[model samples]
Target: MAITDEFLPVPVPESLSATYLVPTARGSGAKPAEAVAALGERLSDPVGDLALQMIDSPLMTVDTRPVSQFPELPPDLLAAFGATPGQLEQLRTANELVVVQAGYRPGWPPVHEWSARAVAAAIAQSLDGDLIDVFSLQFLDPATALRSLPDNDGRLRLVDWILVPYSPTDTGLWFTTKGLRRFGLLELQAQEVPAQFTRAWGAIMTGAARRLLRIWTESLTEQDVPAFVQLPIETTVTGHDIAVAYGSPERHDSAGSAGLRLDLDPATDPDADSFLTLLPPAGQAAAPAEYFAQICTRLFGSGQPEIRYTRPSDAMARAVETARRSLRSARDRFLIGGLPPGVQLVVKYGLATDEGQEFVWASVTSWSNPGRIVATSTSDAASDPTVRVGTPVVVETADVVDWALLDGRGVIEGGWTQAVLDERL
Candidate 1:
């Protein structure tokens, strides 16, 4: 399959692998046969293609000669990877470094990822060693990395193989994926986007992978990706809510992987928030955020209550100043965001209380010299429960926090809060 304008394709990866540096395992005299046997026994079902590949070849290897060998990483680089001094010492000097790898062929991703990671992690645990997520820059104990096999219904935890982090570079801010290449799919990214939009990218990028695979599995034609992906007003699939372009790595440090860059063209993505764009035509809406949250809970939960919220960071506060500066321009382009045939305009009024200040979105009903007469709110997100959507409340903009104007097709201008709220997420 090829990446077309309408549909993004999942190209077969040139290489798919999970690599781990296990110290003191092979040097301590652990055998490859033992690891393989243990993995097979642990699997509930009979060996499939992945198991066949493993059984037919070597899964764990260490240098047989006298010369010592191990993975090499600079001290500062390791520290940047969140590695502790203890981890650094072990990796640098360990003479018996066993490289546990699970390699797969082109046709499969879910099974391959599950099987390969499961095998590598299971072996590491058996040998009492550690594993690292090279892209996420994370070191892991074997038990923490281990995953349960597919259940009776054959459902796989698809989210495990993809991660989107808010990656910033000296040149620019970016949102990029660390794991899509594992499935032979292009890693996803969005450039120069607001920091808050990073959370939305998580759902969109992962959703794209699932969408592309479904297209292939069903043999469908190229369906156009949305120009703007919205947190759907409903769980309905409207193809205009989001978009991304197929491309190559722009940054020198990206590991040179294939990429699917989200179309955060200033007018559309700034306020889209991508509420719900992962559904099929007439399909029940599933917010990728909500779905992935459930998936993580089911697979990783320890039966303990999760601490789900955190206070906004310092960076988020800075965005407020940036938004405030842009308010004059937003007012200047009151109807159209300059990128418009002027579809809609909503101004945000900041409500301050003893606890904190909150920004509310309201449709502009009238205009004054320095204020806007906003109509019944398009949203019911106000602190006052009585101010529901369509509740006729003539709001006086005493304090204008920020605002976003939409063009005819839903392109947005000036929604700084989206990026701000993402910090909390």
Candidate 2:
């Protein structure tokens, strides 16, 4: 689909209209002053020099007032545009212009319709011919983030990034480098009407085009607009809570062994889909599929279980609670198990110190009796690793956050599991 389908165009005002105008210097092939002079006897108002002021980058001020807005214009601007009286009149009512607040100023200064034409001319003059010919421009909302695609070797590459942050404000324009064959230049091909104009405007504002727009605004329009910065917003599914629930043997006896169900909630669980299904805790059952099917019958009974997942922000709070409970009694250790080997963890010191969450990696040094769970900076022999020899609980109810598991090959995967030294021994 065309990028235009993704955004809403600014609504046109009723009192006056704005449209992009091109001068002869920009290759419009018509002169505005000569056109006005040609209508000498027909001229309703005194001929005035056209003045164009920037209301903002990309959108220039135009004076549609039948009476001229400018007392004078630079010889360069006047010399640039040539248009017929009819063409000049058509430019006045064109609906292609976007309204903008004056930069570093308060009120909307009087914009010259003729000046809008001058600005377009200047842009056509400054930009590369290929850029002007190949791309069509339209304004868009600020983009917030970029997602990188992987390279040919399976390594993630920061290629042509796209930001789909779901912002709704109308901010700036984009010139598309794609769809030339299929859609053609958007601005030219769009029907010269308000609806089509708006549609065309919307199509070119993809995140991929924001940088291009910024460059055009700064270089051609002579405006030092602020650069776009991305705000990191965590939208991943990270909430989850784990618990062990037993099923009634008589109720689930037809097709199962020990009917133990592992329930994971959203606020505490990083992996929701698998845990939300209330599967038998990973590694606990001989056959997970059969165990969950039968145990789910007894645990959830016959209806689907309504589970509320927690947001990522809830991590600190949940982790705090688990830490408090674990520190209160040496015998009760918050248990977080089911983590594969080579996982990494970060201990977030809430309200304890100025230091933020500290990242640590987990490596299982031994899988035999009394196996050691080490969380540290690196597994290299030189660096000391923290031996996780804390209290252990029977069920998975420990609060943990800012934690991620890396596979043996060092690729980050998901959550980690905590096993007690006593139980494993």
Model number with the top lDDT: 1
- After best superposition, candidate 1 residue 54: deviation in angstroms? 1.1
Q: What is the TM-score of each candidate against the true structure?
A: 0.46, 0.15
TM-score of 2: 0.15
Candidate 2, residues 234-293, lDDT tens digits: the string is 111100100101112233223322222212122345542111112233455333323322
Positional deviation of 352 in candidate 1, in angstroms? Answer: 14
Going through the candidates in the order shown, the clash numbers are 13, 35
Where in model 1 is the C-alpha error above 4 Å? 1-15, 39-42, 46-53, 58-71, 74-89, 109-115, 133-137, 148-153, 168-173, 197-200, 213-425
lDDT of each: 0.45, 0.24
- Per-residue lDDT of 1-425 in model 1, one digit per residue for the tens? 33445443232334356655555524545454466566654544533335445645664232222215434546675565467777666666556655555655433434445555555565566766665565455566655555434533443444554555554322112455656555444444544332222343454455455554443334422243222212111221111112211111131222212223223222255643221122222232433322322322232222111111224667655665677788767656653434233234566665554556555555554454556464534444435675533334465655765566543233256666655665555
